[model samples]
Target: MTGFHFTVLIQLLYRVGKAPTVILQPNRTVVYRGERVTLRCEIWGGGGTEWTYEWKTNNGNAEKSSNEYIINRVSDTNSGKYSCMARGDHQLTEWSDAVTLTVRLSKPTVILEPSGPVVYRGEKVTLRCEIWGGGGTEWTYEWKTNNGNAEKSSNEYRINRVSDTNSGEYSCMARGDHQLTEWSDAVTLTVRLSKPTVILEPSGPVVYSGEKVTLRCEIWEGGRRTQWTYEWKRNNGNAEKRSREYRIITVNEYHSGKYSCMARGDHQLTEWSDAVTLTVRLPITPTVIKQPSWAQIYRGERVTLRCEIQDDGGTQWTYEWRPNNINSPTSSEFMITADSRGYYSCRGRRDSFTITKWGVITLTVFNSHPAASLSVSPDRVQHLIDQSVTMNCGGNDTKWRMRRFTGSTSPSYVQCSNWGTMHGSSCTINRLEDHSGVYWCESGSGEFSNAVNITVQDDYYDVIILVSPVHPVTEGDPVTLSCRDKEQNLLSNVIFYHNNKLINNDSRGELKISAVSKSDEGFYKCQHSGKESPRSWMSVRGEKD
Candidate 1:
């Protein structure tokens, strides 16, 4: 038996032996990252003398007795074509087929900083590509651009004084020993100048005492937005007392001074705008106020609200609630009144809706909630069996409770799992029975009502009405008119009914009734519903209750 080399291994795998020839079969290929790969080399001969097996990673002289060579954490570095040799000391030899392994890296990523997009031209822009982890050496960096300049570096590249020629497409490549990566996606850069400009204020200024206006700054030749602060003063006598520039809103008699502005640049202030003179004027000190400070009265209440406006920065101010809380020319106070519980407030109306404490004076006349009521369908003391009943509850938000008693000795509880249906402070529960006694609901804190009770009288097991169809049929159906759970708490599949007589008992679903027939209907449609009372409705010629 001979060892394996590229030539020797190829000859054995071609099967140049006799009948019952021995051949090595390899296991399937393709392995996942971090998983173990097992290469099996077994002979296909029917029978033969005991033969030795050899394994190798590549065509290296290294050989092992085991026909299987294992690789742990099968990464791309561990990938290649592998072959095996099978021999029995000097008896015979055989080799196995070769299999290829492909290693793929999770997508690589590039990271850049100065985070928020806006990258300026001529400014330094850095890009770094990072691969998860693959201890490598001897790397290459490549940069491409529409500007047609060669950009290559062992690691990184920097350009100074970037010009119009430096604008447009950009990309990079990372190459390492035995590994090659493609060029990254191209990024475009548009070069723009960084110069400063100006923004105009109002035309001739008769600047008001305390009025606020804006002076805008512009970049006559740049892509970057400029930030600026404004200053104002008179040009009369003291204009030379100012430094580079000054900013202000108000204009008093002293504000009769000259005014100009200065703009900040990347390095320093560019220059100042030509000085402009200003005149001064007095604007009205507008003020008005609202009373009861509101409108509209709530039920069971009389409503009153008022408003007042005055114009005198100084005066022993005394106010009168408006003309019937409506129109009042003279700045004075106003009045409002509410007969019942309502919302109203009063503020210093000397200034229109502005300077006033009207929100604080808001008062509520009365506080009352709805009634704490109680009622049970089928009467609170009636006996019923095999029937479906619904309980409707109303009045202010409330807590609910239901206790049960077999006779009058031991007490149990009636419970509901989950269902939130409270509208207009009303709740409706359906299907009440003997065990559903002492059912009550009450409002939460400050509800102004006591616990309200809902009664259900489904205690005794007796004759329940029998009808062909039930009241309030839900949607479409040839529904079976039948009974549910037995008196013993066991439920019954429904049975269908025609006219007032028993028909077929099958499925129970939506029930649809065609055109009415005098003989096709009857009073009292009943179906057994054990704990869930059977639903029954009487079909009368003309009557709905």
Candidate 2:
């Protein structure tokens, strides 16, 4: 390897380096008027070489012994593309890439937070001074209004409580490091007084309990209608509400007090309204009492209903009735007659504005006599000939006799000895064909009880009878009837008739009447395969209370 003893020398050289890059002090290409800007030429891998920079701009080129070029106060004439080159070690580096600079000379703008400068007195108002292209600059704001000029160190001018004196044409300007910007366009502010008035709906000092009332807060002058929030106070206590009006669906004695209202907007509360006094009077409720107190009355019977108001100290009052009969007396008592089988209500009025709650009652009346009831020992639709049966008469009255009708010109009333054995209220009889008739109990005063039909049938005729209700049925009640043979077995494939006319042919052999009314009362009968039953009478009572 030492043969020849000769060495070779190689020279390595690193060119000056890649092109340098131009950088801004704040790293932003945009600058504002009177703003300080510094441009730097950065070289990488220079090996700690000291370099001098040449800055090129649209205006001209300048050479500096340092790498940084600074503009103390930039103006519109300083806006352009700028680049720099570095010279070190007797070699020149490539020109750095260009950076664009924008300088704005226009005046700043005045911006309000709520946009609209119209506000109410005692409200918070904020005014902001905005510089469109003046980023990265610390500015001092000057607020100029009709009042005077104010030098606020911050960009925002705030008034914690703006008064009427603060309303006027407002303009703003900004001062940065170098010079002061021109005044912006004027923005008008209007401050108004917001004093509310409490208005009662009825406009009356006294209102009856259980009446509807409303209290409205009417603002004298304020901002936009949508900007206001309402608060109601009763006797210095807070009432929760948001709308302008506070309503009470049912005002009672507890609601009676001094009420006032205030409005809030723009972080300010208006003055409380004048208090309005309200007095809620308890209304008198009258009760209706019926004289000769009874649940029911005869058609021609007389009765009296009196409207009595409790705690009334001999106050002269008039009465009002639901029927409002033209010929009715204005007194508290109302005389009921034959046509008085319905609901009755009454109310008392001491004056046009004072009235009591209505009191209501019901009266039931019947057309026929409802004295007693007659029943049989073994209840059945029809009884076999020569079968023993007992009949009983019972009611509030005891003096009664069994009466029967058998197509006779004159009806006969008798005791058990003539037809059956009598004991207390019951009579036992051995049924005969002649005993088949409509039987009932008759009082000594000629009042009769509900009647029943005692049918006696012989087995020889293969007879059938209509099974119907024995007692009178009230209106709006369901009634059903069926057909049966002599053996007491229900029959099918039967056709029913009302008042001797065909009503319907039921598959279930039943005549069903739903919500039976007075029009349904009449004689009802049924017919099976070939035999027809005897027609039975059905009664329907009128509606009652």
Candidate 3:
């Protein structure tokens, strides 16, 4: 059986092979230019033989068969039955189903997504087209406008400029591939008008330091004026407001924000063009800065510091104390019941909002003193040695410390060793000559008690003009001076005036001068008017220095 099988295989392999060839197909079809079409044939299995193919058509006269059948751009003459044949052993003929072609005709489709037929001219827009889905080769597109000649393309057609002339019933034709796809439905595109521009009045470059200014924007291409409002905001900050043409009555640092505008034709507002900003530069900088940045108060003792903004900031200004005890704290004048000593800070907001509040008064509440200790009053004073002194001790009070201030500076004087057992809210120094400074107290919690001042006979003066230029001016050079008391201080900056003219101002115990001469000499004084204290002065001097 194996031998017989091998013999059979050998005989099968010895069979002769014939050349593979191609033949025209039956059921032929025709195509038009710019139309998506397919060319099909009646395929006969030529068994394992690759064949070359050619199609020929008989002229419309039906007498002569020309070998020029087309797959695309098919003319009417290329529409007859195309016959295909193979020629090995003899000529075998295969006739295609008849096809009708139209080369001069084309159908194009229009695909578009209008960004509002009412388009703003000079802005960009697009028109799109695709072969309705499955794309093919030999396809060309034809397009015609109401005013221009027809256009042709393989894929897409575009109208860059659109107007009433360009605005007509738009249509397109797709032609060429082997099979023709039906033409697409037509679409109409209409052109619309654009929005008008706006302008600012009063012309910029006008100086407006304080007051509400009005800015108006006019629209020329007036239609139905919908929401004809304006927009105003700062480059920074949470303050933003809107209205038709902005109206700002009071202007300051906050008012020096940014400004921009857009005209809203009802619900739809045009995009803002370029931005315009108003800058309100401050006339002064704060002089004093505090540590812990806030303060806690007891009842009435008195606390204050002197800080000055800029000298040219003018005298028509007032001062305030900022507690910072509240979140988003604001600057204010005196508000605490008494002198306080705690974490605090301050800044100057325009007083136009309202009067400012402050925090620096002292109030010594006579709470229940510890049974194991006693309490005292009159925290500070001057005295000689052997003077009868009173001291109070309280068992309830555990932590303890004493304070002293001189030359407007505060430093620790006494502290508890075993505070848990120590007592006394008040203690007097026994006739001390070595002490002449401001005083305050502290406990274990690290919170300083209300401040007080104790003085002993002393003849020492330390003065530095922190706010003034070091050198004296000859003629008209700006010069300033600072006077120190080495006594009371200020939470606010201090201002200096010599010869009734403003020289320098600062929160530091100092003063300054911008333009000065020998004639500008006179007496100088500093006063912490923010919350406490009367005016304080420096020793009289001449410009000779």
Best by TM-score: 2
- Top model by lDDT, which number? 2
**All models, RMSD in angstroms:** 26.8, 24.9, 18.6
How many pairs of residues collide in model 2? Answer: 1
lDDT of 1 by residue, 75-107 (tens): 877667666666653445445555566554423
Give one digit per residue, the lDDT tens place, for model 2 in 428-467: 8866656776677777887766556666666556888778
On a 0 to 1 TM-score scale, where does candidate 1 land against the true structure?
Answer: 0.25
- Score residue 159 of candidate 3 by CA lDDT: 50
Provide the TM-score for each candidate, comma-separated.
Answer: 0.25, 0.31, 0.28
Candidate 2 lDDT at 170 equals 80
After superposition, which runs of candidate 2 have C-alpha atoms over 4 Å from their true positions?
1-369, 377-383, 443-447
* lDDT value, candidate 1, whole model: 0.41
Q: What order do candidates take by TM-score, descending?
A: 2, 3, 1
State in Å the error of residue 440, model 2: 2.3
Which residue pairs overlap in candidate 2's backbone? 416-420
